[model samples]
Structure formats: C-alpha cells, structure tokens
Target: MTISLRSRHRWFSALQQLAQSIPYPLRGLLLGLLLWSTLTSAWINPDPVWQAFAPESAIAALGKLLFNGTLWPHIGASLQRVAVGLLAAIAVGVPVGLLFGLVPMIERSASGALQFIRMISPLSWMPIAVMAFGIGDLPVYFLLAIAAVWPILLSTSSGTAAVNHKLLLLARSLCATRSETIRRIVIPAIVPQILVGVRLAIGTIWIVLVPAEMLGVSSGLGYFILDTRDRIAYNELTAVLLAIGIIGCALDWSLQFLQKYWQPSR
Candidate 1:
C-alpha cells in the first residue's frame, strides 16, 4: 500500500511539473488540440455525410478562408457590433447602477419593473427591435445591448452597495464634493467589479451577436455562418464555428487579464 501510494504521488507530481513547464497560452492550445483530436477520432466515419465534417476538410477550409482574406471583413463587422453594444450598455448601466446604489428609495421603487424586464430574454426582443429599427445593424445593436446591460447594471450596483461606509464617511468629513467623492473614492474601488460585469457582458453580447447578425445584415460572422449553411458548405461552417470559439476565448482571456490587473490588493 505504501509503495502504491508513493508511485501515485510520483505520477501526479510528474504531471504537475509537465503542465507547469508549458507556457500558459501554449498549454491552452495543446489542450484544445487534444480535445479536437479526440472529437474527430470519435465522430469521423466512412459515411459520405460524415465526410463533410472530417477534421482535415474543416482545417483546409479554415486555411482557405484565412489565405483568401474572405474572413476578415466578417470578423471586423462582428467586432464592431460587439464594441458598439458593449459601450452602449456601459454608458446606460453604470450611471443607472450608481443611482440605484446611492439612492435606495429609488432602487426599491424600480426594482419590480426592472426585474420583470430583465427576466425576458434579449433574443425575444428581436421582432420588436426589427420592427422599430428596421432590418439593419440597428436592431442587432439593440439586441446585443439589451443582452449585455443586465450584468453590468447588477454588478455595478452590487459593488457600489458593498463600498466601505467608513471610507465614504471620511470623504464626507473631508468635505469632498459629490462628484469628487464618486470620481476618487467610488470609481476606483468599484473598478474590479465593473470589469467583472464587463467580462460577463462581453460573453453575453458575443453569444447574442451571432444570432442577431441574421437580422438582414449583409456582413458579419453570423451572416457568414448562415451563408455557409445555405451553400451547404459544411466544412466552412465547421471552420467558422471553430473561429467563433477561438475569438470568444480570446476576448474572455483579455477581460480576465484586465480584471486581475485591476483587482485590489489584500
């Protein structure tokens, strides 16, 4: 039993060392490749239908898309929409959240209506958005913004409410103006929480952006996805799906890095 335990410990330690030796990005890439290989191995078959989904074909399609420069515009369009939507959400949500946190009476009165609206999925607003804004980027922007706003609003409010009372008292005692107090004391203290909300909002916006692009937009990754499907280009579709995953992962990692950088020292 002692020998078995020792051997197990040695094996775990070896794996730990091996994992540690790889750079962080390389480790993620290696793990992704491993998973991809496993999925290909399990799903590939001799059937003609399955041939469309072969990993080799998808990889070739990805390479072709990159080499031919057909993918850049779509990527750019999607990124633009995400940026616009996220900015809008932040602009509206942050101020509203601050108001709610500072004035409890107002928050209490509006909570019911806010909760009701929030409970509705942003996707469900697609028809209304289209009707109101027409078939263009406007509707897509609206949907993405709606989807992203809830997280930012809630996170900012929570962070504001959790602010140190003593710090606020000290600022008051120092005769700090309201704007100065907010700028110096509240904003910096709540930055980490705001970043967390932004991270969550990015994830939500990305997810909604894909489907929202289907709303008569001529360009975007979402449109590309539909185009591939309409053309029956399964390999290209797979490649686009892979691209989406990679892009989303990259965005999330960036936000994670930002959050860590802004996190308050213990």
Candidate 2:
C-alpha cells in the first residue's frame, strides 16, 4: 500500500511538471481540443434545435460553400464597407477629438450632448437612416460610421488630454508657435493613442457591419446569412457564423500587430 501511494504521488508530480512545461500555444490547442470534444458531444445529443447542423456537417457545408465560390464575394463586399466606413469615421473623429482635447470649453459644453447621443443605440437610427439616405450601401455606411466614430473620438480626446504638460510648457518657453508646437509635439504624442482608438473602432465597425449589410445590401456576409436562413440552409448559416468568428479573430490579430509595431517599446 505504501509503494502504491508513492507510485501515485510520482505520477501526479510528473503530470504536473509536464503541464507546466507545455508552451502556451500547446496549452491553447489542448483547450481547443477539450472545447471541440464538448461541442461534438452536444451535436451528437438528441436535441431538435441542434439537429439543424452538427459540427461535422457544418464543416462539410463550409467546405462545399468555399469550393462552390459562394463565399468570397460576400466577404469582399463586407470588407469594402468596413474600409470605407472606418476611413470616414477616422477622418471626422480625429479632428473633432483633437479640438475637444485642446479646448476645454468645447469639451465641457459638448460632453453632455455627445454622451446623450452616444447613449442612443446606433441601430435605432435604422429607420431614419433608410429614410434619409434611401436603400442600399448608404444606410449601411451611415450605421458603420456612427458605430465606429465614438471610440476614435473618445480615445483621441483622452490621449490628447494625457499629453505631457512639461513638453507643452517647454515648447512655449522656447517660443514655439501654436501651430509648430501642435504639429511637432502634440501630433506625435497623440498618434499612439489615435492608433489605439482606431483599433477599437475597427472592432466595433466589424461587429456592426453584418447587421447593417442585412438592410437591403445585395452582397455581404449579412445578406448571405439571411439568404441561408430563408433557403433553410442551416449548415450554411453555421458555416457563415464560423467564418465570421475566424475572420474577426484574424482582423483583431492584425490590429494587435499594427498596435505593437506602432508602439514597440510602449
């Protein structure tokens, strides 16, 4: 009995050491395996709701959709909308954010109004957006832009406010002109913050893009989702959901790469 106890202790110690030695990526893979196993079991269970598409069937449908050339165009269309909307948001939000940061009075006066508007759901404007801009990409663009702008604006404003006061004072002491101080010191200081904001905006815009695309746009992942639903293609719908998760993860990783590249030391 003592020998058996010693043997069990040794085994547990070895297992613990093995777990600790495993790299992070391997750990993540193990977790993924566990999650996949659970999902597979759930899919196999006798549930009518889940019977719509099992994990294996969803994988097969995704492969079929990919090979049949039914997926790429919608992905491209969604990406295009995201690009255009994000650009517009950056263009408008950055300058406004700068102004808010630089001028205390403007920030104070605008704070309440901006917060009120910001609190309103972007989707709630759907009817007004459709009425004002009409059907198609215009309304979708409006929604995406609105969804993205707040993050950029807030981040830029906060970054600007957080700039080193000593540097500003030094510029003044050196008799630097307002424009020169801002051009050299302020802009550079705020750039990292702006990039952070843009990263956040991209995430918000991507999430909003799908639902916006469903609103009369002929080509986009959202439209594809609706199409699959109407056609009773549950597997295709699941495939699209998987595609969205994969693509979203990729975009987030790309943004993280850019953020690290921009602020390497920070």
Q: Indicate the worst ten consecutive residues by lDDT in candidate 1.
A: 38-47
TM-score of every model versus the real structure: 0.87, 0.85
lDDT of each: 0.91, 0.88
- What would the per-residue lDDT of candidate 1 be over residues 1-266, giving only the tens digit for each residue? 99999999999999999989999989888887776655555355545655566567788898899899999899999999999999999999999988888888988999999999999999999999999999999999999999999999989998998899999999999999999989888888888888999999999999998999999999999999999999999989988988898899999999999987775642
How many angstroms is residue 94 displaced in model 1 relative to the true structure, after the best TM-score fit? 0.5
Give stretches of model 1 more than 4 Å off. 1-44, 263-266
lDDT of 2 by residue, 21-117 (tens): 9999779977975676466566456665564566676778888888999999998999999999999999989999989999979999999999999
Off by over 4 Å in 2: 1-44, 47-52, 264-266
Looking at model 2, the pairs that clash are none
lDDT of 1 at 234: 92
As a TM-score, model 2 comes out at 0.85
